[model samples]
Target: MDNAPNRTLLDLQALEDILQQGAVRTLFQPIYDISKQSILGFEALSRGISGTSLEFPERLFCIASEQGKLSELELLCREKAIARFVEQDLPGKLFINVSPNTLLDPSHPKGETLHLVEKYGLSANRVVIEVTEQDKVDDGFLLLKTIEHYRQLGFSIAIDDLGAGYSGLKQWSELRPDFVKVDRYFIDYCDQSIVKKEFLKSIIELAKVTKTSVIAEGIERLEELTLLEKLGIVHAQGFLLAKPARQPPRALEASQVTQLNLRSQSNHNEMSMSVGCLAQIEDAIGQSTRCKDAHKRFEQNKSLMSLAVINAKQQPVGLLHRDQLTEVFAAPYGHALYAKKSVVELMDKQPLVVDENAKLDVVSQQITEQEFDIRRHIIVTRDLKYLGLAPLRDILKHITEEKIRHAQHANPLTMLPGNVAINEAIEQRLRRQNTFSLAYVDLNHFKQFNDLYGYASGDSVIKLLADVTVQVCDQSSCFVGHIGGDDFMVVFDGDDAERLCHQIINQFELQSKAFFTSEHVEAGGYWATNREGQKQFVPLLTLSIGLVRPDLESCNNSHQVAALATDAKKEAKRYRNSYLFVCNRRKPAAPIVRIKTTVHECSV
Candidate 1:
């Protein structure tokens, strides 16, 4: 035990030697942009010599802090990280960690970081000063001033480990940083905990309001990454995407990129149908044409209400109303006075112009926001080049038709899409020849529960299940539909279908426990009468999910997909607990006498 003092002395000496010799090694971990499927930047992490007492970062930094050399060590790490980053020709921004206490220290040198970056030929604009929340700040005003100093030098600022240390929301609000990274604790198992999910949602919403970009750090599992993506988090840093290394990949793996692209395409397909279908092909006059010429064309074609004025590039510049021209021509000697002038003088230059791919509802909103006369005609374009015109009357008609159709095919209880809409979703996927998974979800022993509880309670349970499914699947590029009564369907466009299925089952089990009485829950079930009027022990409510990956070549329609999913669901019901049965058969054929499947049982 007496040798412990000697060991400590030796460790301190080793740390000193490391600092003097400049033996810090820098490894970069990538921060990914999910929406673009590209690398946004990298966070530089520092380490010491391998196989030594000071090899780990935590020990090295702790010893440095004890030795009153924290600022020196941090400066050395920053220099080395910047040098290595430039030497390796890394891409995007470089995030270097700096403590607040060090910045507030009187002895700490200012402008050193800027000098090193300039010496290494790197731009200050590419470096982000990540203020770590490891130590308390005695003076918040000085720290803010120091941060402002760094900002004036063209350095971006970021707050690290938010919600895990002092001055969390306070620091965030005061700094108004360009980036804020949520701590790892909130990100772990976010999919399983509703509280954590709500916390993240609130953080995201706050970031949106503050106009601050959020980055989720310490992501280690695919489930965590998937949930973060669903919550609208675009920037991420973690082991699942890529580990810290001296040399890292410039782009994601091909398979991962393909999956992201597929999800994006699926989302695009599900967007409201474009307003291009309502476009009416009509003749447009050039901006340089005479007003008299436009008036003559309007007179010849009595149906023409307006003429779109285009420039040399075929882009819409304005709109000329027929009534305006007639009023001008009706004035005393107006035709002789203004007939020779250019049409640009009489055109409405601020007419409503929208892209052909814009949503009908969005275009309607834009039209309604305009003046009464200006809202009469909308100029539609493809890539800024005028294609045709969309009249207000046509837009209103199309929207009315869509509302009627949607009302007819929507489920009354859950307000989810019904059979006709489900079939249409499946057929759309089939037509695109895209490979996707279909899951037919059914409640187990629901009739028995309905018999014991009143219909109101039963309806509550069904709605609860629907709510859980929607909440879990929201923004996941997956479609949810209610077939009827207690049966529902989900279409998955990504590869994480099985994991998502488990989430749904787990969430349903936890939320459904409220419907049962305490005595019934402890007993594991309740005494109920079966359909044959015989007394039996019916288990609590559970879910049965039948999943099938449909083959684009063999499965030609939604009917075939539905049939295969139904068969798979039968196999899932055989298990007593909540379960998932994945069908191996891709083709739609006669029901097999012997089934081939894989089953996963989920414990409540």
Candidate 2:
């Protein structure tokens, strides 16, 4: 009668028995190299037997900490995890979590983890001892020394869950870990949250200055990972990228990798805007060539504005302008006086030779800021080797064209991207096979409000709605489009789709009252004729957001996503007042069942 099958908490005796019996297990979660499109490493997560009080890893660790068996339990988990990591013949670095308290334990076996790794015949370099900050360490000096000792033994150090724990930055400053794992809380919807974006930005900047690498953890959305890539945080780990499993994946989603690369290419194209449309490599004159020979070559190419003088090593030493050289040869006996001399003697010594990859804006600035007349032609080079030349006029023309193209595609009312850009964004996401939420936001009861208030007032309402959406969305990651009229589209490339739409609904409702008449505001409705010409009461201006998500395998193209999202939007319109309807379609692998949906109604 006293014997009970289950207990609320795992008994201390049971914990000891589990450890003695070697019942601990390990699962591996992959860390992705977004740029490389490959598995960079795997983080080893410890697990306990199911149907037991120690089934939960967190509970197991907590009980161990309370019982002063933290070091013993951690070491056991590490041993079991690493043994399996070797047994599975897993590829990539093995990231093992170790509490700082356990790291500084006086009785803790020093270099035991290292020995375990060596015992498995795995290189110490492949093992990254992640110093977890869950338990705060009081003595910084001891912790630093302990981390350093591991470093000297050839183990790379990492700080886990950077922003989640106390003194994460302090440890980062003191220990200067080889890598810092950003906390999941900040990464959840980082693409749609400015606060998160700015916070991660500062961390990335800090990493750059300190020469430490950053690993964005808990990236569960394509948009979040996309933003991380744009910010140059290439190393990442999350459920969206890959989930924890018994074995590492052969590779990540090829489409997602392609999408990240496409974005990088787009950024490269933007940077090239500084260089204009000028050729990457232009013709140049060798310094060893005689002045007369250089003159003959310039004469051969009548369109040449200037020629770059390069030495034996292909390094640019000077510039020879057609106008100045022509002026020189025009003088009486000038050709005879300088015919035999090397081009270096006649060429302008202070030449402006820029790297081929230099931005056009930077090159233009250099040209305008120079004391000498460097406006003739800019000599471009790659790794000091002559590449090409660009005239000032060509750069200016390209810049103007780029600006004109952007302006042409922008929406006239809100100045946001119109249909073309939105299509391109959708296609780009589809190509990468990244999961992103597409929300179709259309105003509710807009025809009645527009008909009553006139087009001018309606335009004002549309602009206000645009302002609210832009204000709530993370401008860095979210794409807002003015599709046309009262129908707007927002593609959330991050995980904060639900929260973002609700915020938009909340803001629009609170602000729409200002545009209503006193009587309409008091009554909360306006009398309007239906399509049949019968009089009916219509609600005030409110927004209906229909959200849909299409992953790579589920959706073949942007059109499919648009169609599904439109369907979701129609579903949302069925409800009165402000409403949000999300399409929660499951993947094909899941057993097909009755379709389920979630509707959120906002009465305000």
Best by TM-score: 1
TM-score, structure 1 vs. true: 0.54
For model 2, how does the per-residue alpha-carbon lDDT over 99-143 read when each residue is reduced to its tens digit? 988888887888798678756666555689998776678998999
- After superposition, which runs of candidate 2 have C-alpha atoms over 4 Å from their true positions? 1-10, 255-604
Of candidate 2, the 10-residue stretch with the lowest lDDT total is: 262-271
The candidate that wins on lDDT is: 1
Instruction: State the number of backbone clashes in model 2.
Output: 11
lDDT of 1: 0.84
Instruction: Show how many residue pairs clash in every candidate, following the order shown.
Output: 0, 11
Candidate 2 similarity to native, TM-score: 0.45
**Candidate 1 local lDDT, 1-604, one digit each (tens):** 5898887797798888888899898999999877656677899999898888788888888888888899999999999999998798787779999989889888899889988876776656568899986579999999999998887666788999988899999999899787999999899888899998998999999988776789999988788888888799989999878899989777788676544431332332143468888889998998679999999999999999999988765767678899999999999998998799988778865567777987787677656544345346888888657899888888877877876776788889998878987888899899988778999999998999998888998999999988887776653567888999999999998787887888899999888989999999899899998778899998899999999999999998899999999999999999999999999999998656977898999999
